[model samples]
Target: MSTAQALSPSSRAESLKKLEETELDVLVIGGGVVGAGSALDAATRGLKVGLVEARDFASGTSSRSSKLFHGGLRYLEQFNFALVFEALRERSLVLNSLCPHLAKPVPFIYPLEKLIDRPYVGLGIGVYDVMGAGRGVPSHHKHVGKKKTLESFPSGKRSAIRGSVKFYEGQVDDARHTMMLARTAAEYGALCVNSTRVIGFLREEGRVVGVKAVDLETGRAFEIRARQVINAAGVWTDEIQEMVGGRGQFQVRASKGVHLVVPRNRINSSTGIITRTEKSLLFVIPWGSHWIIGTTDTDWNLDLAHPAA
Candidate 1:
Protein backbone atom coordinates (compact mmCIF):
# COMPACT_ATOMS: atom_id res chain seq x y z
CA MET A 1 0.00 0.00 0.00
CA SER A 2 3.03 2.27 0.31
CA THR A 3 3.41 3.76 -3.16
CA ALA A 4 6.95 5.07 -2.74
CA GLN A 5 7.93 1.54 -1.71
CA ALA A 6 5.76 -0.11 -4.34
CA LEU A 7 6.99 -1.75 -7.50
CA SER A 8 6.69 0.93 -10.13
CA PRO A 9 7.22 0.92 -13.88
CA SER A 10 10.36 3.04 -13.63
CA SER A 11 11.69 0.88 -10.80
CA ARG A 12 10.98 -2.33 -12.68
CA ALA A 13 12.78 -0.99 -15.73
CA GLU A 14 15.80 -0.04 -13.66
CA SER A 15 15.86 -3.45 -11.95
CA LEU A 16 15.68 -5.33 -15.24
CA LYS A 17 18.66 -3.38 -16.47
CA LYS A 18 20.52 -4.05 -13.27
CA LEU A 19 19.81 -7.76 -13.60
CA GLU A 20 21.24 -7.84 -17.09
CA GLU A 21 24.32 -5.75 -16.28
CA THR A 22 25.27 -6.57 -12.72
CA GLU A 23 26.66 -9.84 -11.40
CA LEU A 24 24.63 -10.45 -8.26
CA ASP A 25 25.66 -12.34 -5.14
CA VAL A 26 22.21 -13.89 -4.95
CA LEU A 27 19.37 -14.42 -7.43
CA VAL A 28 16.15 -15.28 -5.59
CA ILE A 29 13.33 -16.96 -7.50
CA GLY A 30 9.72 -16.32 -6.43
CA GLY A 31 8.29 -13.13 -4.90
CA GLY A 32 6.43 -14.65 -1.99
CA VAL A 33 7.33 -13.85 1.62
CA VAL A 34 10.05 -16.50 1.73
CA GLY A 35 11.65 -15.15 -1.41
CA ALA A 36 11.25 -11.54 -0.31
CA GLY A 37 12.65 -12.30 3.15
CA SER A 38 15.63 -14.01 1.56
CA ALA A 39 16.22 -10.97 -0.61
CA LEU A 40 15.96 -8.67 2.41
CA ASP A 41 18.38 -10.79 4.44
CA ALA A 42 20.89 -11.00 1.62
CA ALA A 43 20.69 -7.30 0.79
CA THR A 44 21.02 -6.27 4.45
CA ARG A 45 24.15 -8.41 4.64
CA GLY A 46 25.59 -6.20 1.83
CA LEU A 47 25.23 -8.79 -0.88
CA LYS A 48 24.08 -7.78 -4.36
CA VAL A 49 20.67 -9.37 -4.92
CA GLY A 50 17.92 -9.92 -7.49
CA LEU A 51 14.40 -11.31 -7.02
CA VAL A 52 12.05 -12.58 -9.74
CA GLU A 53 8.49 -13.82 -9.43
CA ALA A 54 6.14 -15.24 -12.06
CA ARG A 55 3.19 -13.38 -10.60
CA ASP A 56 2.27 -10.77 -8.02
CA PHE A 57 3.67 -11.03 -4.53
CA ALA A 58 1.73 -13.45 -2.33
CA SER A 59 -0.21 -14.73 -5.35
CA GLY A 60 0.36 -18.21 -4.01
CA THR A 61 -0.19 -19.87 -0.65
CA SER A 62 1.51 -17.16 1.35
CA SER A 63 -1.66 -15.11 1.00
CA ARG A 64 -4.00 -18.03 1.57
CA SER A 65 -2.73 -19.20 4.93
CA SER A 66 -4.93 -19.52 8.01
CA LYS A 67 -3.95 -15.81 8.52
CA LEU A 68 -3.17 -16.48 12.18
CA PHE A 69 0.41 -16.11 13.27
CA HIS A 70 -0.12 -18.15 16.42
CA GLY A 71 1.75 -20.92 18.13
CA GLY A 72 -0.40 -23.75 16.79
CA LEU A 73 -2.23 -24.37 20.03
CA ARG A 74 -4.09 -27.31 18.54
CA TYR A 75 -0.78 -29.04 17.99
CA LEU A 76 -0.44 -29.29 21.74
CA GLU A 77 -3.06 -32.03 21.66
CA GLN A 78 -0.75 -34.00 19.39
CA PHE A 79 2.25 -33.47 21.71
CA ASN A 80 4.09 -31.37 19.14
CA PHE A 81 5.65 -29.17 21.75
CA ALA A 82 8.74 -28.11 19.83
CA LEU A 83 6.81 -26.99 16.77
CA VAL A 84 4.44 -24.94 18.88
CA PHE A 85 7.29 -23.30 20.74
CA GLU A 86 9.17 -22.40 17.58
CA ALA A 87 6.08 -20.99 15.85
CA LEU A 88 5.16 -18.90 18.89
CA ARG A 89 8.66 -17.52 19.10
CA GLU A 90 8.51 -16.46 15.47
CA ARG A 91 5.06 -15.00 16.08
CA SER A 92 6.53 -12.92 18.87
CA LEU A 93 9.31 -11.65 16.64
CA VAL A 94 6.80 -10.55 14.04
CA LEU A 95 4.25 -8.94 16.30
CA ASN A 96 6.67 -7.35 18.77
CA SER A 97 9.74 -6.67 16.66
CA LEU A 98 9.66 -7.53 12.99
CA CYS A 99 6.62 -5.76 11.44
CA PRO A 100 4.22 -4.76 14.14
CA HIS A 101 2.31 -2.50 11.78
CA LEU A 102 1.14 -5.39 9.64
CA ALA A 103 0.02 -7.68 12.45
CA LYS A 104 -1.89 -7.45 15.73
CA PRO A 105 -3.51 -9.48 18.45
CA VAL A 106 -6.91 -11.09 17.77
CA PRO A 107 -8.92 -13.04 20.30
CA PHE A 108 -10.64 -16.35 19.64
CA ILE A 109 -13.20 -18.29 21.66
CA TYR A 110 -13.03 -22.06 21.45
CA PRO A 111 -16.48 -23.18 22.49
CA LEU A 112 -16.84 -26.53 24.19
CA GLU A 113 -19.40 -28.90 22.71
CA LYS A 114 -19.57 -32.26 24.44
CA LEU A 115 -19.54 -32.28 28.26
CA ILE A 116 -16.75 -34.89 28.37
CA ASP A 117 -14.35 -32.81 26.20
CA ARG A 118 -13.59 -30.05 28.75
CA PRO A 119 -10.86 -31.81 30.77
CA TYR A 120 -8.90 -32.88 27.69
CA VAL A 121 -9.33 -29.51 25.98
CA GLY A 122 -8.37 -27.63 29.14
CA LEU A 123 -5.23 -29.75 29.55
CA GLY A 124 -4.23 -29.13 25.94
CA ILE A 125 -4.71 -25.40 26.39
CA GLY A 126 -2.65 -25.62 29.60
CA VAL A 127 0.22 -27.05 27.59
CA TYR A 128 -0.34 -24.27 25.05
CA ASP A 129 0.15 -21.73 27.84
CA VAL A 130 3.35 -23.45 28.94
CA MET A 131 4.78 -23.47 25.44
CA GLY A 132 3.86 -19.86 24.82
CA ALA A 133 5.07 -18.61 28.21
CA GLY A 134 7.23 -15.45 28.14
CA ARG A 135 6.21 -14.75 24.58
CA GLY A 136 4.68 -11.27 24.11
CA VAL A 137 1.25 -12.83 23.70
CA PRO A 138 -0.82 -13.65 26.73
CA SER A 139 -0.15 -17.30 27.56
CA HIS A 140 -3.16 -17.77 29.86
CA HIS A 141 -6.59 -18.86 28.66
CA LYS A 142 -9.83 -17.31 29.93
CA HIS A 143 -12.47 -19.78 31.08
CA VAL A 144 -15.86 -18.57 29.85
CA GLY A 145 -19.11 -20.08 30.95
CA LYS A 146 -22.03 -20.64 28.57
CA LYS A 147 -23.54 -17.31 29.58
CA LYS A 148 -20.37 -15.43 28.77
CA THR A 149 -19.91 -17.45 25.61
CA LEU A 150 -23.35 -16.40 24.44
CA GLU A 151 -22.49 -12.85 25.28
CA SER A 152 -19.51 -13.01 22.91
CA PHE A 153 -21.23 -14.91 20.09
CA PRO A 154 -24.99 -14.59 20.21
CA SER A 155 -25.48 -16.07 16.75
CA GLY A 156 -23.99 -19.44 17.69
CA LYS A 157 -26.30 -22.44 17.61
CA ARG A 158 -27.51 -23.14 21.17
CA SER A 159 -26.60 -26.84 21.10
CA ALA A 160 -22.97 -26.08 20.18
CA ILE A 161 -22.16 -23.75 23.08
CA ARG A 162 -21.50 -25.75 26.24
CA GLY A 163 -18.88 -23.17 27.36
CA SER A 164 -15.71 -21.62 25.97
CA VAL A 165 -12.00 -20.88 26.36
CA LYS A 166 -10.68 -17.53 25.10
CA PHE A 167 -7.14 -17.13 23.83
CA TYR A 168 -5.13 -14.60 21.83
CA GLU A 169 -3.27 -14.94 18.54
CA GLY A 170 -1.73 -12.62 16.01
CA GLN A 171 -3.41 -11.89 12.69
CA VAL A 172 -2.02 -10.14 9.63
CA ASP A 173 -3.14 -8.69 6.37
CA ASP A 174 -1.12 -11.36 4.60
CA ALA A 175 -1.17 -9.80 1.13
CA ARG A 176 -0.06 -6.42 2.42
CA HIS A 177 2.59 -7.97 4.65
CA THR A 178 4.07 -9.88 1.73
CA MET A 179 4.23 -6.79 -0.50
CA MET A 180 5.90 -4.83 2.28
CA LEU A 181 8.59 -7.50 2.55
CA ALA A 182 9.35 -7.24 -1.14
CA ARG A 183 9.35 -3.44 -1.01
CA THR A 184 11.54 -3.39 2.07
CA ALA A 185 14.03 -5.62 0.30
CA ALA A 186 13.91 -3.26 -2.65
CA GLU A 187 14.52 -0.30 -0.36
CA TYR A 188 17.56 -2.15 0.93
CA GLY A 189 18.92 -2.35 -2.64
CA ALA A 190 17.58 -5.72 -3.79
CA LEU A 191 16.48 -5.63 -7.44
CA CYS A 192 13.01 -7.02 -6.72
CA VAL A 193 10.93 -7.66 -9.85
CA ASN A 194 7.56 -9.37 -9.93
CA SER A 195 5.69 -10.67 -13.02
CA THR A 196 9.00 -11.98 -14.23
CA ARG A 197 9.11 -15.71 -14.88
CA VAL A 198 12.21 -17.85 -14.68
CA ILE A 199 12.23 -19.88 -17.89
CA GLY A 200 15.53 -21.65 -17.36
CA PHE A 201 18.71 -21.71 -15.34
CA LEU A 202 22.02 -20.35 -16.55
CA ARG A 203 24.68 -22.99 -16.04
CA GLU A 204 28.45 -23.35 -16.42
CA GLU A 205 30.22 -26.72 -16.20
CA GLY A 206 27.09 -28.31 -14.66
CA ARG A 207 26.75 -25.64 -11.95
CA VAL A 208 23.99 -23.04 -11.86
CA VAL A 209 25.39 -19.54 -12.16
CA GLY A 210 22.30 -17.48 -12.92
CA VAL A 211 18.82 -17.60 -14.42
CA LYS A 212 17.13 -16.95 -17.77
CA ALA A 213 13.96 -14.99 -17.16
CA VAL A 214 11.19 -13.46 -19.26
CA ASP A 215 9.11 -10.45 -18.43
CA LEU A 216 5.54 -11.67 -18.20
CA GLU A 217 4.16 -8.45 -19.59
CA THR A 218 6.67 -7.77 -22.40
CA GLY A 219 7.59 -11.35 -23.32
CA ARG A 220 11.23 -10.41 -23.61
CA ALA A 221 13.86 -12.83 -22.31
CA PHE A 222 16.99 -11.77 -20.45
CA GLU A 223 19.82 -13.54 -18.67
CA ILE A 224 21.01 -12.68 -15.19
CA ARG A 225 24.28 -13.81 -13.66
CA ALA A 226 24.68 -14.56 -9.98
CA ARG A 227 26.98 -16.47 -7.68
CA GLN A 228 24.04 -18.35 -6.17
CA VAL A 229 20.39 -19.01 -7.07
CA ILE A 230 17.66 -19.73 -4.51
CA ASN A 231 14.45 -21.50 -5.49
CA ALA A 232 11.59 -20.35 -3.30
CA ALA A 233 8.90 -20.80 -5.92
CA GLY A 234 6.49 -22.48 -3.47
CA VAL A 235 4.17 -24.90 -5.32
CA TRP A 236 6.22 -24.63 -8.50
CA THR A 237 9.39 -25.50 -6.58
CA ASP A 238 9.62 -28.97 -8.10
CA GLU A 239 9.54 -27.47 -11.57
CA ILE A 240 12.52 -25.26 -10.82
CA GLN A 241 14.39 -28.24 -9.36
CA GLU A 242 13.69 -30.24 -12.50
CA MET A 243 15.03 -27.38 -14.60
CA VAL A 244 18.18 -27.54 -12.48
CA GLY A 245 18.39 -31.16 -13.70
CA GLY A 246 19.04 -32.79 -10.33
CA ARG A 247 17.16 -35.16 -8.09
CA GLY A 248 15.33 -33.10 -5.53
CA GLN A 249 15.81 -33.83 -1.81
CA PHE A 250 12.14 -33.17 -1.06
CA GLN A 251 9.06 -32.69 -3.17
CA VAL A 252 6.63 -29.80 -2.94
CA ARG A 253 2.91 -30.49 -2.93
CA ALA A 254 0.15 -27.99 -3.67
CA SER A 255 -2.81 -27.74 -1.35
CA LYS A 256 -5.89 -25.78 -2.39
CA GLY A 257 -7.58 -23.57 0.20
CA VAL A 258 -10.41 -21.04 0.01
CA HIS A 259 -11.89 -18.48 2.46
CA LEU A 260 -15.37 -17.04 2.55
CA VAL A 261 -15.81 -13.45 3.65
CA VAL A 262 -19.06 -12.36 5.21
CA PRO A 263 -20.30 -9.19 6.85
CA ARG A 264 -19.49 -8.85 10.56
CA ASN A 265 -23.14 -8.37 11.40
CA ARG A 266 -23.93 -11.88 10.20
CA ILE A 267 -21.85 -13.58 12.89
CA ASN A 268 -22.72 -11.07 15.66
CA SER A 269 -19.60 -12.08 17.57
CA SER A 270 -17.27 -9.99 19.65
CA THR A 271 -14.53 -12.61 19.25
CA GLY A 272 -13.53 -14.97 16.48
CA ILE A 273 -14.33 -18.71 16.64
CA ILE A 274 -12.40 -21.94 16.01
CA THR A 275 -14.02 -25.29 15.31
CA ARG A 276 -12.82 -28.67 14.17
CA THR A 277 -13.88 -30.20 10.92
CA GLU A 278 -13.71 -33.90 10.21
CA LYS A 279 -10.19 -33.56 8.83
CA SER A 280 -9.04 -30.10 9.84
CA LEU A 281 -9.91 -27.06 11.94
CA LEU A 282 -11.83 -24.10 10.47
CA PHE A 283 -11.41 -20.55 11.69
CA VAL A 284 -13.94 -17.75 11.71
CA ILE A 285 -11.52 -14.88 12.05
CA PRO A 286 -12.39 -11.26 12.71
CA TRP A 287 -11.34 -9.11 9.76
CA GLY A 288 -12.10 -5.49 10.57
CA SER A 289 -15.77 -5.07 9.73
CA HIS A 290 -15.95 -8.51 8.10
CA TRP A 291 -15.51 -12.11 9.23
CA ILE A 292 -13.54 -14.67 7.28
CA ILE A 293 -14.88 -18.23 7.34
CA GLY A 294 -13.13 -20.87 5.47
CA THR A 295 -11.28 -23.07 4.31
CA THR A 296 -11.25 -26.41 2.45
CA ASP A 297 -7.83 -28.06 2.19
CA THR A 298 -7.40 -30.78 -0.39
CA ASP A 299 -4.65 -31.88 -2.75
CA TRP A 300 -4.77 -29.63 -5.79
CA ASN A 301 -4.68 -31.24 -9.24
CA LEU A 302 -6.36 -28.65 -11.41
CA ASP A 303 -5.16 -25.26 -12.54
CA LEU A 304 -2.65 -23.68 -10.19
CA ALA A 305 -3.85 -20.16 -10.98
CA HIS A 306 -7.51 -20.83 -10.34
CA PRO A 307 -9.46 -23.40 -8.30
CA ALA A 308 -13.05 -24.51 -8.81
CA ALA A 309 -15.79 -23.87 -6.29
Candidate 2:
Protein backbone atom coordinates (compact mmCIF):
# COMPACT_ATOMS: atom_id res chain seq x y z
CA MET A 1 0.00 0.00 0.00
CA SER A 2 1.00 3.56 -0.69
CA THR A 3 1.79 5.62 2.39
CA ALA A 4 0.51 8.74 0.71
CA GLN A 5 3.83 10.56 0.92
CA ALA A 6 4.59 9.79 4.57
CA LEU A 7 8.10 10.64 5.74
CA SER A 8 10.90 8.29 6.79
CA PRO A 9 11.43 7.58 10.52
CA SER A 10 14.09 10.19 11.04
CA SER A 11 12.11 12.66 8.97
CA ARG A 12 9.02 12.01 11.05
CA ALA A 13 11.01 12.56 14.20
CA GLU A 14 12.33 15.80 12.79
CA SER A 15 8.77 16.84 11.88
CA LEU A 16 7.58 16.08 15.42
CA LYS A 17 10.41 18.16 16.80
CA LYS A 18 9.52 21.04 14.50
CA LEU A 19 5.84 20.85 15.49
CA GLU A 20 6.88 21.36 19.11
CA GLU A 21 9.47 23.96 18.29
CA THR A 22 7.30 26.21 16.13
CA GLU A 23 3.74 27.54 16.29
CA LEU A 24 2.08 26.93 12.92
CA ASP A 25 -0.64 28.93 11.21
CA VAL A 26 -2.80 25.89 10.60
CA LEU A 27 -3.06 22.38 11.99
CA VAL A 28 -5.39 20.16 9.96
CA ILE A 29 -6.80 16.88 11.24
CA GLY A 30 -7.81 14.02 8.90
CA GLY A 31 -6.10 12.95 5.67
CA GLY A 32 -9.16 12.90 3.41
CA VAL A 33 -9.69 15.21 0.45
CA VAL A 34 -11.04 18.16 2.41
CA GLY A 35 -8.18 18.00 4.91
CA ALA A 36 -5.63 17.70 2.10
CA GLY A 37 -7.20 20.59 0.24
CA SER A 38 -7.21 22.77 3.35
CA ALA A 39 -3.53 22.05 3.96
CA LEU A 40 -2.72 22.87 0.36
CA ASP A 41 -4.64 26.14 0.50
CA ALA A 42 -2.96 27.20 3.75
CA ALA A 43 0.52 26.29 2.56
CA THR A 44 0.00 28.01 -0.77
CA ARG A 45 -0.75 31.23 1.11
CA GLY A 46 2.71 30.81 2.74
CA LEU A 47 1.33 29.65 6.08
CA LYS A 48 3.16 27.13 8.25
CA VAL A 49 0.95 24.03 8.28
CA GLY A 50 0.75 20.55 9.77
CA LEU A 51 -1.76 17.80 8.86
CA VAL A 52 -2.32 14.67 10.90
CA GLU A 53 -4.32 11.60 9.86
CA ALA A 54 -5.53 8.73 11.98
CA ARG A 55 -4.85 6.19 9.25
CA ASP A 56 -3.65 5.88 5.67
CA PHE A 57 -4.62 8.66 3.29
CA ALA A 58 -8.04 8.15 1.65
CA SER A 59 -8.58 5.16 3.92
CA GLY A 60 -11.91 6.61 4.99
CA THR A 61 -14.94 7.76 2.94
CA SER A 62 -12.83 9.83 0.57
CA SER A 63 -11.72 6.71 -1.29
CA ARG A 64 -15.28 5.44 -1.59
CA SER A 65 -16.87 8.29 -3.55
CA SER A 66 -18.92 7.40 -6.63
CA LYS A 67 -15.80 8.42 -8.64
CA LEU A 68 -17.93 10.89 -10.63
CA PHE A 69 -17.84 14.63 -10.32
CA HIS A 70 -21.26 15.53 -11.68
CA GLY A 71 -24.03 18.08 -11.55
CA GLY A 72 -27.18 16.42 -10.32
CA LEU A 73 -29.67 16.83 -13.15
CA ARG A 74 -32.23 14.96 -11.06
CA TYR A 75 -32.09 17.84 -8.63
CA LEU A 76 -34.01 19.87 -11.21
CA GLU A 77 -37.25 18.63 -9.64
CA GLN A 78 -36.24 20.51 -6.50
CA PHE A 79 -35.14 23.49 -8.65
CA ASN A 80 -31.54 23.17 -7.48
CA PHE A 81 -30.03 24.75 -10.58
CA ALA A 82 -27.40 26.71 -8.69
CA LEU A 83 -25.99 23.55 -7.12
CA VAL A 84 -25.96 21.77 -10.46
CA PHE A 85 -24.16 24.63 -12.16
CA GLU A 86 -21.59 24.92 -9.40
CA ALA A 87 -20.91 21.19 -9.53
CA LEU A 88 -20.47 21.31 -13.31
CA ARG A 89 -17.99 24.14 -12.96
CA GLU A 90 -15.90 22.20 -10.46
CA ARG A 91 -16.12 19.08 -12.65
CA SER A 92 -14.80 21.02 -15.63
CA LEU A 93 -11.89 22.38 -13.60
CA VAL A 94 -10.93 18.94 -12.37
CA LEU A 95 -11.06 17.42 -15.85
CA ASN A 96 -9.35 20.35 -17.56
CA SER A 97 -6.85 21.64 -15.01
CA LEU A 98 -6.61 20.08 -11.57
CA CYS A 99 -6.16 16.37 -12.43
CA PRO A 100 -6.87 15.66 -16.08
CA HIS A 101 -5.09 12.34 -16.12
CA LEU A 102 -7.16 11.02 -13.22
CA ALA A 103 -10.57 12.38 -14.31
CA LYS A 104 -12.14 11.64 -17.67
CA PRO A 105 -15.47 11.48 -19.53
CA VAL A 106 -17.94 8.65 -19.09
CA PRO A 107 -21.07 8.51 -21.25
CA PHE A 108 -24.42 7.91 -19.52
CA ILE A 109 -27.72 6.69 -20.96
CA TYR A 110 -30.94 7.99 -19.45
CA PRO A 111 -33.57 5.64 -20.85
CA LEU A 112 -36.97 7.04 -21.77
CA GLU A 113 -39.88 4.64 -21.35
CA LYS A 114 -42.53 6.49 -23.36
CA LEU A 115 -42.72 8.42 -26.60
CA ILE A 116 -44.67 11.19 -24.89
CA ASP A 117 -41.85 11.54 -22.38
CA ARG A 118 -39.32 12.38 -25.12
CA PRO A 119 -39.86 16.13 -25.50
CA TYR A 120 -40.14 16.82 -21.76
CA VAL A 121 -37.14 14.71 -20.81
CA GLY A 122 -35.10 16.14 -23.68
CA LEU A 123 -35.91 19.69 -22.61
CA GLY A 124 -34.88 18.99 -19.03
CA ILE A 125 -31.64 17.39 -20.16
CA GLY A 126 -31.07 20.37 -22.43
CA VAL A 127 -31.44 22.66 -19.46
CA TYR A 128 -29.03 20.46 -17.55
CA ASP A 129 -26.53 20.77 -20.42
CA VAL A 130 -26.93 24.54 -20.51
CA MET A 131 -26.27 24.80 -16.79
CA GLY A 132 -22.88 23.21 -17.43
CA ALA A 133 -22.13 25.90 -19.98
CA GLY A 134 -18.49 26.83 -20.79
CA ARG A 135 -17.15 23.59 -19.39
CA GLY A 136 -14.51 22.01 -21.67
CA VAL A 137 -16.10 18.67 -20.93
CA PRO A 138 -18.82 17.66 -23.40
CA SER A 139 -22.10 19.24 -22.30
CA HIS A 140 -24.32 18.00 -25.12
CA HIS A 141 -26.84 15.21 -24.69
CA LYS A 142 -27.48 12.90 -27.64
CA HIS A 143 -30.86 11.39 -28.54
CA VAL A 144 -30.49 7.67 -29.28
CA GLY A 145 -33.21 5.48 -30.73
CA LYS A 146 -34.17 2.26 -29.01
CA LYS A 147 -32.10 0.10 -31.37
CA LYS A 148 -29.06 2.31 -30.99
CA THR A 149 -29.45 2.29 -27.22
CA LEU A 150 -29.47 -1.49 -27.21
CA GLU A 151 -26.45 -1.56 -29.49
CA SER A 152 -24.62 0.54 -26.94
CA PHE A 153 -25.84 -1.34 -23.88
CA PRO A 154 -26.98 -4.83 -24.83
CA SER A 155 -27.59 -5.80 -21.25
CA GLY A 156 -30.51 -3.42 -20.73
CA LYS A 157 -34.05 -4.74 -21.10
CA ARG A 158 -35.65 -3.37 -24.27
CA SER A 159 -39.10 -3.07 -22.67
CA ALA A 160 -37.80 -0.63 -20.08
CA ILE A 161 -36.15 1.70 -22.57
CA ARG A 162 -38.25 3.14 -25.39
CA GLY A 163 -35.27 5.38 -26.24
CA SER A 164 -32.21 6.78 -24.51
CA VAL A 165 -30.35 10.04 -24.03
CA LYS A 166 -26.58 9.87 -23.88
CA PHE A 167 -24.50 12.49 -22.13
CA TYR A 168 -20.97 12.94 -20.83
CA GLU A 169 -20.03 13.31 -17.17
CA GLY A 170 -16.77 13.23 -15.19
CA GLN A 171 -15.27 10.10 -13.65
CA VAL A 172 -12.15 9.69 -11.52
CA ASP A 173 -10.05 7.35 -9.44
CA ASP A 174 -11.23 8.56 -6.03
CA ALA A 175 -8.42 7.08 -3.97
CA ARG A 176 -5.70 8.25 -6.33
CA HIS A 177 -7.24 11.69 -6.73
CA THR A 178 -7.45 12.14 -2.96
CA MET A 179 -3.88 10.85 -2.54
CA MET A 180 -2.67 13.31 -5.17
CA LEU A 181 -4.23 16.15 -3.20
CA ALA A 182 -2.19 15.17 -0.12
CA ARG A 183 0.93 14.76 -2.22
CA THR A 184 0.42 18.18 -3.76
CA ALA A 185 -0.17 19.70 -0.31
CA ALA A 186 3.10 18.21 0.88
CA GLU A 187 4.85 19.52 -2.21
CA TYR A 188 3.57 22.96 -1.23
CA GLY A 189 5.20 22.54 2.24
CA ALA A 190 2.41 21.03 4.40
CA LEU A 191 3.66 18.46 6.88
CA CYS A 192 1.50 15.44 5.94
CA VAL A 193 1.58 12.72 8.57
CA ASN A 194 -0.64 9.60 8.48
CA SER A 195 -1.25 6.91 11.11
CA THR A 196 -1.26 9.61 13.79
CA ARG A 197 -4.45 9.70 15.88
CA VAL A 198 -5.64 12.80 17.66
CA ILE A 199 -6.18 11.74 21.23
CA GLY A 200 -7.48 15.10 22.41
CA PHE A 201 -7.47 18.78 21.78
CA LEU A 202 -5.17 21.38 23.34
CA ARG A 203 -7.57 24.01 24.60
CA GLU A 204 -6.52 27.25 26.29
CA GLU A 205 -9.37 29.08 28.06
CA GLY A 206 -12.50 28.98 25.88
CA ARG A 207 -10.75 28.71 22.51
CA VAL A 208 -8.99 25.83 20.74
CA VAL A 209 -5.26 25.98 20.05
CA GLY A 210 -4.00 22.61 18.86
CA VAL A 211 -4.09 18.84 19.38
CA LYS A 212 -2.48 16.05 21.38
CA ALA A 213 -1.84 13.12 19.05
CA VAL A 214 -0.27 9.67 19.18
CA ASP A 215 1.98 8.30 16.48
CA LEU A 216 0.40 4.88 15.81
CA GLU A 217 3.58 3.32 14.47
CA THR A 218 5.94 4.22 17.29
CA GLY A 219 3.32 4.59 20.03
CA ARG A 220 4.79 8.00 20.83
CA ALA A 221 2.77 10.98 22.00
CA PHE A 222 3.27 14.52 20.68
CA GLU A 223 1.54 17.89 20.73
CA ILE A 224 0.93 20.22 17.79
CA ARG A 225 0.31 23.89 18.49
CA ALA A 226 -1.32 26.13 15.92
CA ARG A 227 -3.14 29.42 15.55
CA GLN A 228 -6.06 27.59 13.86
CA VAL A 229 -7.09 23.95 14.04
CA ILE A 230 -9.44 22.40 11.48
CA ASN A 231 -11.41 19.21 11.87
CA ALA A 232 -11.95 17.64 8.49
CA ALA A 233 -12.69 14.34 10.13
CA GLY A 234 -15.74 13.50 7.95
CA VAL A 235 -18.10 11.25 9.95
CA TRP A 236 -15.88 11.54 12.99
CA THR A 237 -16.37 15.28 13.11
CA ASP A 238 -19.05 15.00 15.80
CA GLU A 239 -16.73 12.99 17.98
CA ILE A 240 -13.93 15.52 17.61
CA GLN A 241 -16.33 18.35 18.33
CA GLU A 242 -17.58 16.65 21.49
CA MET A 243 -13.98 16.15 22.62
CA VAL A 244 -13.57 19.94 22.60
CA GLY A 245 -16.54 20.22 25.02
CA GLY A 246 -19.05 21.58 22.51
CA ARG A 247 -21.57 19.99 20.24
CA GLY A 248 -21.19 21.33 16.74
CA GLN A 249 -24.04 23.17 15.04
CA PHE A 250 -24.81 20.04 13.06
CA GLN A 251 -24.61 16.30 13.59
CA VAL A 252 -22.95 13.91 11.18
CA ARG A 253 -24.76 10.66 10.43
CA ALA A 254 -22.64 7.90 8.93
CA SER A 255 -23.86 6.18 5.76
CA LYS A 256 -22.37 2.97 4.48
CA GLY A 257 -21.93 2.70 0.71
CA VAL A 258 -21.22 -0.58 -1.07
CA HIS A 259 -19.61 -1.05 -4.50
CA LEU A 260 -18.88 -4.16 -6.54
CA VAL A 261 -15.97 -4.52 -8.95
CA VAL A 262 -16.17 -6.86 -11.90
CA PRO A 263 -14.02 -7.58 -14.95
CA ARG A 264 -14.72 -5.46 -18.05
CA ASN A 265 -15.57 -8.52 -20.13
CA ARG A 266 -18.50 -9.33 -17.88
CA ILE A 267 -20.30 -6.06 -18.63
CA ASN A 268 -21.00 -5.44 -22.31
CA SER A 269 -21.06 -1.70 -22.74
CA SER A 270 -19.54 0.87 -25.08
CA THR A 271 -19.61 3.45 -22.28
CA GLY A 272 -20.45 3.77 -18.61
CA ILE A 273 -24.13 3.57 -17.60
CA ILE A 274 -26.42 5.03 -14.94
CA THR A 275 -29.97 3.77 -14.44
CA ARG A 276 -32.74 4.78 -12.09
CA THR A 277 -33.88 2.65 -9.18
CA GLU A 278 -36.74 2.87 -6.78
CA LYS A 279 -34.63 4.23 -3.95
CA SER A 280 -31.55 5.59 -5.75
CA LEU A 281 -29.45 5.67 -8.90
CA LEU A 282 -27.24 2.72 -9.93
CA PHE A 283 -24.08 3.52 -11.83
CA VAL A 284 -21.81 1.09 -13.65
CA ILE A 285 -18.55 2.97 -14.01
CA PRO A 286 -15.69 1.86 -16.21
CA TRP A 287 -12.49 1.43 -14.26
CA GLY A 288 -9.23 0.45 -15.90
CA SER A 289 -9.94 -3.18 -16.91
CA HIS A 290 -13.01 -3.51 -14.77
CA TRP A 291 -16.46 -2.10 -14.00
CA ILE A 292 -17.50 -0.74 -10.61
CA ILE A 293 -21.19 -1.47 -10.18
CA GLY A 294 -23.08 -0.43 -7.11
CA THR A 295 -23.52 2.14 -4.40
CA THR A 296 -26.05 0.94 -1.91
CA ASP A 297 -26.54 3.74 0.62
CA THR A 298 -28.03 3.10 4.06
CA ASP A 299 -27.54 4.17 7.65
CA TRP A 300 -24.51 2.76 9.40
CA ASN A 301 -24.39 2.18 13.16
CA LEU A 302 -21.50 -0.22 13.43
CA ASP A 303 -17.81 0.38 14.02
CA LEU A 304 -16.80 3.76 12.65
CA ALA A 305 -13.25 2.63 11.93
CA HIS A 306 -14.19 -0.50 9.96
CA PRO A 307 -17.72 -0.73 8.55
CA ALA A 308 -18.65 -4.23 7.43
CA ALA A 309 -20.51 -4.82 4.16
Segments of candidate 1 deviating more than 4 angstroms: 1-4
- Model 2: per-residue lDDT, tens digit, 149-256? 999988778788788888888988888887888877777778878889998989888778888999998898988899999999999999899888889877999988
lDDT of each: 0.86, 0.84
Give the lDDT of residue 228 in candidate 2.
Answer: 96
| Deviation from native of the Cα of residue 72 in model 2, angstroms | 2.3
Q: Write the per-residue lDDT of candidate 1 for residues 185-271, one digit (tens) a residue.
A: 898889998889999998899888999999988999999999999999888888899989865887978777888999998888898
Q: Compute the lDDT of residue 23 as modeled in candidate 1.
A: 96
RMSD of 1: 2.1
Q: Candidate 2, residue 160: CA error in Å?
A: 3.4
